[model samples]
Target: MPWTLPSRPSRRSLLAGAAGVAGAALLTGCSDDRPAGGESGIPLERRMREAAVRDSARLLERYDATAADHPALAARLAPLRAAVAAHSAALALPPAGSRSPSASPTGGTGAAAPSAGGEPVPPKPAEALTALADAERSLSEARTIDLAGAPGELARMLASVAACGAVHAYLLTSTPGATS
Candidate 1:
Protein backbone atom coordinates (compact mmCIF):
# COMPACT_ATOMS: atom_id res chain seq x y z
CA MET A 1 0.00 0.00 0.00
CA PRO A 2 1.17 3.47 -0.91
CA TRP A 3 1.42 6.08 1.88
CA THR A 4 -0.51 9.24 1.14
CA LEU A 5 0.38 12.80 2.18
CA PRO A 6 -1.64 14.28 5.04
CA SER A 7 -4.17 16.99 4.26
CA ARG A 8 -3.16 20.58 4.91
CA PRO A 9 -4.31 22.07 8.21
CA SER A 10 -7.32 24.36 8.03
CA ARG A 11 -6.75 28.01 8.90
CA ARG A 12 -9.05 27.84 11.90
CA SER A 13 -7.29 24.77 13.24
CA LEU A 14 -3.91 26.33 12.72
CA LEU A 15 -4.96 29.49 14.51
CA ALA A 16 -6.42 27.56 17.42
CA GLY A 17 -3.25 25.54 17.80
CA ALA A 18 -1.18 28.70 17.68
CA ALA A 19 -3.30 30.29 20.37
CA GLY A 20 -2.94 27.27 22.61
CA VAL A 21 0.80 27.37 22.21
CA ALA A 22 0.91 31.08 23.00
CA GLY A 23 -1.23 30.63 26.10
CA ALA A 24 0.91 27.76 27.29
CA ALA A 25 3.98 29.89 26.80
CA LEU A 26 2.46 32.63 28.91
CA LEU A 27 1.47 30.15 31.61
CA THR A 28 4.89 28.59 31.64
CA GLY A 29 6.54 31.96 32.05
CA CYS A 30 4.23 32.84 34.93
CA SER A 31 4.60 29.54 36.74
CA ASP A 32 7.73 30.54 38.68
CA ASP A 33 7.37 28.93 42.13
CA ARG A 34 9.29 31.31 44.34
CA PRO A 35 7.87 31.93 47.81
CA ALA A 36 4.76 34.09 47.63
CA GLY A 37 5.48 36.33 50.59
CA GLY A 38 8.92 37.64 51.43
CA GLU A 39 10.48 38.66 54.74
CA SER A 40 8.59 41.96 54.58
CA GLY A 41 5.29 40.07 54.18
CA ILE A 42 4.62 41.65 50.82
CA PRO A 43 4.03 39.18 48.04
CA LEU A 44 6.38 38.87 45.07
CA GLU A 45 3.94 40.62 42.74
CA ARG A 46 3.60 43.61 45.06
CA ARG A 47 7.33 43.91 45.43
CA MET A 48 7.69 43.77 41.67
CA ARG A 49 5.14 46.52 41.28
CA GLU A 50 6.87 48.66 43.86
CA ALA A 51 10.20 48.14 42.20
CA ALA A 52 8.73 49.11 38.82
CA VAL A 53 7.32 52.30 40.33
CA ARG A 54 10.66 53.17 41.84
CA ASP A 55 12.43 52.52 38.55
CA SER A 56 9.98 54.71 36.69
CA ALA A 57 10.44 57.47 39.25
CA ARG A 58 14.19 57.30 38.86
CA LEU A 59 13.90 57.38 35.07
CA LEU A 60 11.62 60.39 35.38
CA GLU A 61 14.21 62.11 37.51
CA ARG A 62 16.88 61.34 34.96
CA TYR A 63 14.77 62.85 32.22
CA ASP A 64 14.19 65.97 34.30
CA ALA A 65 17.83 66.35 35.14
CA THR A 66 18.86 65.90 31.52
CA ALA A 67 16.31 68.47 30.43
CA ALA A 68 17.49 71.00 33.02
CA ASP A 69 21.14 70.46 32.25
CA HIS A 70 20.54 70.84 28.55
CA PRO A 71 17.76 73.37 28.15
CA ALA A 72 18.09 73.38 24.39
CA LEU A 73 16.70 69.82 24.27
CA ALA A 74 13.86 70.56 26.67
CA ALA A 75 11.21 71.09 24.01
CA ARG A 76 12.03 67.81 22.31
CA LEU A 77 12.19 65.92 25.58
CA ALA A 78 8.96 67.15 27.19
CA PRO A 79 6.59 64.62 25.66
CA LEU A 80 8.82 61.67 26.42
CA ARG A 81 9.27 62.92 29.99
CA ALA A 82 5.52 63.18 30.38
CA ALA A 83 5.11 59.62 29.13
CA VAL A 84 7.56 58.41 31.79
CA ALA A 85 5.65 60.31 34.47
CA ALA A 86 2.43 58.66 33.35
CA HIS A 87 4.05 55.23 33.61
CA SER A 88 5.15 56.02 37.18
CA ALA A 89 1.65 57.00 38.24
CA ALA A 90 0.09 54.00 36.59
CA LEU A 91 2.46 51.67 38.43
CA ALA A 92 1.76 53.15 41.89
CA LEU A 93 -0.14 50.81 44.21
CA PRO A 94 -3.36 51.73 45.96
CA PRO A 95 -3.64 51.52 49.75
CA ALA A 96 -3.80 47.95 50.98
CA GLY A 97 -7.38 46.59 50.75
CA SER A 98 -8.54 49.86 49.22
CA ARG A 99 -8.85 48.29 45.78
CA SER A 100 -9.10 44.97 44.07
CA PRO A 101 -5.84 43.27 43.13
CA SER A 102 -6.80 42.89 39.46
CA ALA A 103 -7.76 46.55 39.22
CA SER A 104 -5.30 49.00 37.66
CA PRO A 105 -2.62 50.77 39.65
CA THR A 106 -3.84 53.64 41.84
CA GLY A 107 -3.36 55.60 45.11
CA GLY A 108 -0.84 58.08 43.82
CA THR A 109 -1.75 61.04 41.64
CA GLY A 110 1.91 61.10 40.56
CA ALA A 111 5.27 59.58 41.31
CA ALA A 112 7.21 61.26 44.08
CA ALA A 113 10.24 62.93 42.58
CA PRO A 114 13.24 60.59 42.65
CA SER A 115 16.85 61.29 42.03
CA ALA A 116 19.26 59.10 40.06
CA GLY A 117 21.82 61.32 41.77
CA GLY A 118 25.47 62.35 41.64
CA GLU A 119 26.24 61.98 37.94
CA PRO A 120 26.35 65.26 36.07
CA VAL A 121 24.52 65.56 32.76
CA PRO A 122 26.59 65.42 29.60
CA PRO A 123 27.75 68.73 28.26
CA LYS A 124 26.64 68.28 24.65
CA PRO A 125 23.00 68.07 23.62
CA ALA A 126 23.57 64.91 21.57
CA GLU A 127 25.50 63.31 24.37
CA ALA A 128 22.74 64.07 26.86
CA LEU A 129 20.12 62.50 24.64
CA THR A 130 22.31 59.46 24.16
CA ALA A 131 22.63 59.07 27.91
CA LEU A 132 18.90 59.33 28.36
CA ALA A 133 18.31 56.83 25.58
CA ASP A 134 20.76 54.43 27.19
CA ALA A 135 18.92 54.60 30.48
CA GLU A 136 15.56 53.98 28.81
CA ARG A 137 16.92 51.04 26.84
CA SER A 138 18.50 49.45 29.89
CA LEU A 139 15.35 49.79 31.97
CA SER A 140 13.18 48.48 29.16
CA GLU A 141 15.30 45.35 28.86
CA ALA A 142 15.09 44.77 32.61
CA ARG A 143 11.30 45.10 32.58
CA THR A 144 11.08 42.70 29.66
CA ILE A 145 13.09 40.14 31.58
CA ASP A 146 10.84 40.69 34.61
CA LEU A 147 7.62 39.81 32.78
CA ALA A 148 8.34 36.14 33.29
CA GLY A 149 8.01 36.53 37.06
CA ALA A 150 5.11 38.97 37.13
CA PRO A 151 1.47 37.97 37.63
CA GLY A 152 -1.25 38.72 35.08
CA GLU A 153 -2.29 42.35 35.34
CA LEU A 154 1.13 43.54 36.40
CA ALA A 155 2.75 41.65 33.57
CA ARG A 156 0.55 43.39 31.03
CA MET A 157 1.38 46.81 32.46
CA LEU A 158 5.09 46.03 32.52
CA ALA A 159 5.00 45.00 28.89
CA SER A 160 3.28 48.23 27.87
CA VAL A 161 5.64 50.41 29.89
CA ALA A 162 8.64 48.53 28.57
CA ALA A 163 7.51 49.04 24.99
CA CYS A 164 7.07 52.74 25.68
CA GLY A 165 10.56 52.98 27.09
CA ALA A 166 11.99 51.35 23.97
CA VAL A 167 10.10 53.81 21.83
CA HIS A 168 11.37 56.70 23.90
CA ALA A 169 14.90 55.47 23.41
CA TYR A 170 14.41 55.41 19.65
CA LEU A 171 12.79 58.82 19.53
CA LEU A 172 15.40 60.54 21.62
CA THR A 173 18.10 59.45 19.23
CA SER A 174 16.17 60.34 16.09
CA THR A 175 13.71 63.13 16.75
CA PRO A 176 11.05 63.28 14.00
CA GLY A 177 11.29 67.06 13.85
CA ALA A 178 14.94 66.95 13.08
CA THR A 179 15.91 67.70 9.47
CA SER A 180 18.36 64.78 9.25
Candidate 2:
Protein backbone atom coordinates (compact mmCIF):
# COMPACT_ATOMS: atom_id res chain seq x y z
CA MET A 1 0.00 0.00 0.00
CA PRO A 2 1.24 3.51 -0.86
CA TRP A 3 1.50 6.03 2.03
CA THR A 4 -0.58 9.19 1.43
CA LEU A 5 0.29 12.79 2.56
CA PRO A 6 -1.68 14.06 5.59
CA SER A 7 -4.45 16.52 4.73
CA ARG A 8 -4.01 20.26 5.59
CA PRO A 9 -5.77 21.50 8.76
CA SER A 10 -9.06 23.32 8.16
CA ARG A 11 -9.15 27.03 9.10
CA ARG A 12 -11.76 26.45 11.83
CA SER A 13 -9.70 23.68 13.39
CA LEU A 14 -6.56 25.85 13.35
CA LEU A 15 -8.45 28.75 14.91
CA ALA A 16 -9.94 26.49 17.62
CA GLY A 17 -6.54 25.13 18.51
CA ALA A 18 -5.12 28.65 18.76
CA ALA A 19 -7.99 29.77 20.95
CA GLY A 20 -7.55 26.80 23.27
CA VAL A 21 -3.88 27.59 23.72
CA ALA A 22 -4.63 31.26 24.38
CA GLY A 23 -7.31 30.38 26.93
CA ALA A 24 -4.94 28.15 28.76
CA ALA A 25 -2.31 30.90 28.84
CA LEU A 26 -4.84 33.42 30.12
CA LEU A 27 -5.87 31.14 32.95
CA THR A 28 -2.33 30.40 33.98
CA GLY A 29 -1.23 33.99 33.76
CA CYS A 30 -3.87 35.00 36.31
CA SER A 31 -2.38 32.80 39.02
CA ASP A 32 -2.25 34.29 42.53
CA ASP A 33 1.52 33.86 42.86
CA ARG A 34 2.29 37.22 41.23
CA PRO A 35 3.44 40.06 43.51
CA ALA A 36 0.83 42.59 44.57
CA GLY A 37 0.98 46.43 44.45
CA GLY A 38 3.39 48.64 42.53
CA GLU A 39 7.18 48.31 42.14
CA SER A 40 8.39 46.31 45.11
CA GLY A 41 5.11 47.20 46.87
CA ILE A 42 6.61 50.52 48.08
CA PRO A 43 5.16 52.79 45.40
CA LEU A 44 8.15 53.94 43.36
CA GLU A 45 5.99 56.65 41.84
CA ARG A 46 5.46 58.30 45.21
CA ARG A 47 9.17 58.36 45.85
CA MET A 48 9.83 59.88 42.42
CA ARG A 49 7.22 62.56 43.07
CA GLU A 50 8.72 63.39 46.44
CA ALA A 51 12.19 63.68 44.97
CA ALA A 52 10.88 66.01 42.27
CA VAL A 53 9.32 68.21 44.95
CA ARG A 54 12.51 68.39 46.96
CA ASP A 55 14.63 69.21 43.90
CA SER A 56 12.21 71.92 42.80
CA ALA A 57 12.30 73.47 46.25
CA ARG A 58 16.09 73.45 46.23
CA LEU A 59 16.17 75.06 42.77
CA LEU A 60 13.84 77.79 44.01
CA GLU A 61 16.09 78.43 46.97
CA ARG A 62 19.10 78.70 44.69
CA TYR A 63 17.25 81.18 42.51
CA ASP A 64 16.42 83.25 45.56
CA ALA A 65 20.03 83.29 46.64
CA THR A 66 21.18 84.26 43.14
CA ALA A 67 18.63 87.08 42.97
CA ALA A 68 19.59 88.45 46.36
CA ASP A 69 23.30 88.44 45.60
CA HIS A 70 22.90 90.27 42.31
CA PRO A 71 19.95 92.58 42.69
CA ALA A 72 20.62 93.73 39.14
CA LEU A 73 19.49 90.35 37.90
CA ALA A 74 16.41 90.09 40.14
CA ALA A 75 13.99 91.28 37.46
CA ARG A 76 15.36 88.88 34.91
CA LEU A 77 15.38 85.91 37.30
CA ALA A 78 11.89 86.47 38.70
CA PRO A 79 10.07 84.54 36.00
CA LEU A 80 12.42 81.57 36.28
CA ARG A 81 11.94 81.51 40.03
CA ALA A 82 8.17 81.59 39.57
CA ALA A 83 8.35 78.63 37.20
CA VAL A 84 10.35 76.64 39.74
CA ALA A 85 7.76 77.49 42.40
CA ALA A 86 4.96 76.22 40.18
CA HIS A 87 6.83 72.98 39.51
CA SER A 88 7.41 72.55 43.23
CA ALA A 89 3.72 73.05 44.00
CA ALA A 90 2.69 70.53 41.36
CA LEU A 91 5.13 67.90 42.61
CA ALA A 92 4.31 68.56 46.28
CA LEU A 93 0.69 67.52 45.82
CA PRO A 94 0.33 63.95 47.10
CA PRO A 95 -2.28 61.41 46.01
CA ALA A 96 -5.62 61.30 47.88
CA GLY A 97 -5.19 60.68 51.64
CA SER A 98 -1.42 61.05 51.39
CA ARG A 99 0.58 64.02 52.68
CA SER A 100 3.63 65.39 50.93
CA PRO A 101 6.71 64.03 52.65
CA SER A 102 8.63 66.77 54.43
CA ALA A 103 11.49 68.16 52.34
CA SER A 104 14.07 70.61 53.54
CA PRO A 105 12.13 73.72 54.47
CA THR A 106 12.75 76.38 51.83
CA GLY A 107 13.40 78.57 54.83
CA GLY A 108 11.22 81.74 54.81
CA THR A 109 10.88 84.55 52.32
CA GLY A 110 14.45 85.84 51.86
CA ALA A 111 15.40 82.64 53.62
CA ALA A 112 17.98 82.07 50.91
CA ALA A 113 19.20 85.62 51.14
CA PRO A 114 22.90 85.96 50.56
CA SER A 115 24.52 86.19 53.99
CA ALA A 116 27.46 84.62 55.73
CA GLY A 117 25.47 81.48 56.48
CA GLY A 118 23.37 81.50 53.38
CA GLU A 119 23.93 79.66 50.08
CA PRO A 120 27.09 80.63 48.26
CA VAL A 121 26.44 83.41 45.77
CA PRO A 122 27.76 83.45 42.22
CA PRO A 123 29.93 86.49 41.54
CA LYS A 124 28.08 87.49 38.38
CA PRO A 125 24.57 87.41 36.95
CA ALA A 126 25.73 85.38 33.97
CA GLU A 127 27.26 82.73 36.20
CA ALA A 128 24.03 82.36 38.18
CA LEU A 129 21.94 82.01 35.03
CA THR A 130 24.40 79.50 33.64
CA ALA A 131 24.12 77.44 36.79
CA LEU A 132 20.34 77.49 36.66
CA ALA A 133 20.36 76.50 33.01
CA ASP A 134 22.75 73.66 33.73
CA ALA A 135 20.52 72.42 36.52
CA GLU A 136 17.42 72.51 34.33
CA ARG A 137 19.23 70.59 31.62
CA SER A 138 20.24 67.95 34.15
CA LEU A 139 16.68 67.52 35.43
CA SER A 140 15.37 67.24 31.88
CA GLU A 141 17.86 64.47 31.16
CA ALA A 142 16.92 62.64 34.36
CA ARG A 143 13.21 62.86 33.52
CA THR A 144 13.91 61.26 30.17
CA ILE A 145 15.37 58.25 31.99
CA ASP A 146 12.51 58.19 34.47
CA LEU A 147 9.82 58.16 31.77
CA ALA A 148 10.67 54.60 30.86
CA GLY A 149 9.48 53.06 34.16
CA ALA A 150 6.61 55.44 35.00
CA PRO A 151 2.95 54.53 34.55
CA GLY A 152 1.03 56.11 31.67
CA GLU A 153 -0.34 59.12 33.52
CA LEU A 154 2.90 59.73 35.39
CA ALA A 155 4.97 59.25 32.25
CA ARG A 156 2.92 61.95 30.56
CA MET A 157 3.46 64.28 33.49
CA LEU A 158 7.19 63.54 33.55
CA ALA A 159 7.47 64.20 29.83
CA SER A 160 5.71 67.52 30.25
CA VAL A 161 7.97 68.46 33.14
CA ALA A 162 11.02 67.48 31.15
CA ALA A 163 9.90 69.63 28.24
CA CYS A 164 9.34 72.55 30.59
CA GLY A 165 12.82 72.16 31.99
CA ALA A 166 14.32 72.15 28.51
CA VAL A 167 12.39 75.33 27.70
CA HIS A 168 13.60 76.95 30.89
CA ALA A 169 17.18 76.13 30.02
CA TYR A 170 16.75 77.57 26.56
CA LEU A 171 15.22 80.75 27.90
CA LEU A 172 17.96 81.19 30.45
CA THR A 173 20.64 80.77 27.85
CA SER A 174 19.06 82.73 24.99
CA THR A 175 17.58 85.76 26.69
CA PRO A 176 18.61 89.01 24.98
CA GLY A 177 20.59 90.36 27.89
CA ALA A 178 22.17 87.03 28.84
CA THR A 179 25.95 87.05 28.65
CA SER A 180 27.66 84.67 26.26
Q: Model 1: which ten-residue window has the lowest total lDDT?
A: 29-38
Residue clash pairs of candidate 2: none
Q: Candidate 1: deviation at residue 128, Å?
A: 0.3
What value does the lDDT take at residue 26 in candidate 2? 42
Instruction: Tell me, by TM-score, which candidate is best.
Output: 1
Pairs clashing within candidate 1: none
Q: Write the per-residue lDDT of candidate 2 for residues 69-104, one digit (tens) a residue.
A: 889888888987887777666665554444546533
- Tell me each candidate's TM-score: 0.72, 0.62
Name model 2 segments beyond 4 Å from true: 1-41, 95-119, 177-180
Candidate 1, residues 1-180: lDDT per residue as tens digits? 999756998898899998997676467456442446445666666678778888887787888889899888899899999898788777776434546655556334544555636357889999999999999999999998787667766777888999999999999899666785
How many pairs in model 2 have backbone atoms within 3 A of each other, for residues 3 or more apart or on separate chains, i.e. clashes? 0
What overall lDDT goes with each candidate model?
Answer: 0.78, 0.68
User: For candidate 1, what is the TM-score?
Assistant: 0.72
